[model samples]
Target: MTTIKGELLEGETETGMAAAAQGGQYGAAAERASEAKRALRLAVASSMVSKVCSIGLQAVSIPLFARVLDTDDFSAMMVYFGVTAWLSLVAIGIWPTVTSIAADDRRRGQLAGVLTVSWVGLSAIFASLIVLVLVLRPVLEQSGINLFSARHYSLFTAALVCYAMLTVLSVGEAVNQGQHRQHVNNLITAAGSILNVVFILLVTYFRPPGEEHVDVTLLFVASQAGFILIRVVNMIGVVVRAGWPHAFPGKAFARELARNSWSLLQAQLAVVFLQQGAVLLCYETDMPRDAALLALLFRANLLLHSFVYMINQPLWPIIHRNMLAGDWQWVIRIYRKLATCYVAYGLLAIIGAAFVGGAAVSLWTAGEYPISNKLATLCAVYFALLVTSAASTPVLMGAKAFVSLGNIGMAEFLAAGVLCTILYFADAVSFPHVVEALIAANAMTALWMMPTQAIVRLSRGSLDAQH
Candidate 1:
């Protein structure tokens, strides 16, 4: 650990230590500050490697998808992902809530208590979800909501079931994050990306022009098997490292987790609505091409954001730990630096979007799909607004300001929903119009409101610490 601190600190800015000293009452907790930095460095490094691997895999897989798959197939893929993203809502923020609780518990040597509660809660939720999916299957089928045609519905169902299992099992990931072992989770992610590339390669080789050389269902099964393998492996590692929960936690602790999860659920639901819901909206409005285009754009934006989030995500646990130690001053200083980086990245992304987004899309899709500069610029602006709000997300989450975050998310969701409804009634629900509504909604919440709320929460936390 000392060697790691020396190596990481050698490359780290002097600002953190300097800021710690300047933070007035850093207390005895100040001594552990270097350890936090070490953990954060590992998290960032692992995330970077994982993301870079994903980018490389995508560089190979996306063009194959664009060229090899029919429009229906491609659209089906997007819908599959969009629907799975919605599955996140089922957790109702339990995952992050558990992660936050686990971080606090680790400091107090009560990690087993939190883990046991999370396992019981998530397992029950998963079982309920299975029942829900089975019950809804017939209803949705009979409802005639044919996004992917009758033939592909079975494949879609299978894939979604696999993803549902993956989501529930992701408590393992939350466990690792709280323990500062994000590298293991990250490596598992890289392995998943590798599996994705292999799946794409199989598709490319077997699903050649005018002939189906491989059973598509078999490929799907293979992919799901790979996902289950990696996730289960990660889960086993987490249990070995953290140990099984010694005992089920008290009902009060469970209830508190539920309360926090409910608050965060609102935010998570809004996020899903803004992102995946938009793609589904395009499809429902009878705009298949628009749906495909928007999905592609969102995919591009997400790829860029993932790199930024690699740095941002490590902050959740680190800040939560510091906040528990009453190191509010250090938290505030770190946030200021993070906010600066967000602004800089947002500007550069906008510039890049204006100058090269369309060209980049065309190149990425091997000229299969071309986008306009206007659309590209709008996408960039939307992404900038979204990322800006995210600047304070970790800080707010760490501060346990769930209600404030939830309210902003609810506002943003309502704004987007109302505006989309208005556009639909006005017979003006075009691609650009939907994107514009999203931008407006995000501008209202993310651009200023979220950051302001974060500052307020930080101030309150600082005051409490001093008292």
Candidate 2:
């Protein structure tokens, strides 16, 4: 009887220990969840404020530019902005890769290496930009692209150089973000927006009210300088406070970053197509009228998309942190909430835009650009898909599923381009048809990407737990 009792007691003790271990894990997970939730809230709130300021400034500047600059100068300025946007992404996958690796390094108390890597990567990218500018400027000027107009080519080149300088320095923001402080970047951006407004106001104040006027070069240079100063200060603060380590990271770490960046570049290029492809399609199809409408519609959609992007910007680091923790359940939970919120917001924005968007556009443009309901709706659907894909980005990026993203994105763009081409040749092309093709193409991408990621992540998490 005593032997049996002793055996029973041993069994009970083992059960109790197991329960305690499980409970300890649950407690730790709950704590992590709480921390993540708080971080996201703060990030979103800051991003919201930043985005509001940006959107407001943009609203102010657009009409201000339209009113002040002549049609040619205004068009040239818009093209200049577009070119700079592409230039800003010249670092491409480097940003995300650095951000993710930086997060991992921080968790392991080894951020110094990643920080050095980021600077090295930025330096290389800056050199490449300089080379490209020198090599491409002559070719582009000879080609007579609208952006390189003889009148403003020199100014544009100077402005681009300034912009490139600032862009390289902006890597600071990526590193800070990985440290779970995206608000630093948001603050920098908000300040830059305010400065841009000031520059615009100055331009408006000094305007000649005719064809000859203050070109965008001064404004661009001023804004870029302001951004650079703010970012440099922030970078210094971050590095100094983090206590820069003396140890140098090995080449393997750099190689790892390079490999990841290459994969990410593919994905980033795919995104560029989705964002800019509509305007190109309109131009190619010879639908100038539709092109104008598409431009307006895209701008309107972009404003709404900006809000989504703002939220996701901060959420990205949080996702990376949880991903590093091997907390798949937490990631999924957050993802579901995020995806649902995005879809709901997209649906509501589409519905709201369908109602007030036309009137709003009319008022904003002072009745210059009138949007039709059909065109507005199609644009909304396309951007909704775009933003949804964007929402899934941090997750795929966290998983380092860059190759899959590239493949799907490539296929999506190709399909859209082919379908649009067929319609154009068949003489059935319209802005609406082009948008519809985009919708179909992106839908395939989203359908494949999101589900597959979830399954793979869940499986991986399960295996991890079992081990």
Candidate 1 lDDT for residue 330: 83
Error of 2 at 343 (Å): 1.5
| Residue 70 CA displacement from its true place in model 2, Å | 3.0
Give one digit per residue, the lDDT tens place, for model 1 in 230-271: 888887776677765666557766677777878888888787
Task: Report the C-alpha displacement of residue 451, candidate 1, in angstroms.
Answer: 0.7
Residue 103 Cα positional deviation in candidate 2, in Å, after optimal superposition: 1.7
**237-287 per-residue lDDT for model 2 (tens digits):** 767765667666677666766676676556556556654555555544555
- Runs in model 1 lying further than 4 Å from the true structure: 1-27, 105-110, 131-138, 207-226
lDDT of 1 at 325: 80
For every candidate, C-alpha RMSD to the true structure in Å: 8.4, 3.6
lDDT of each: 0.76, 0.68
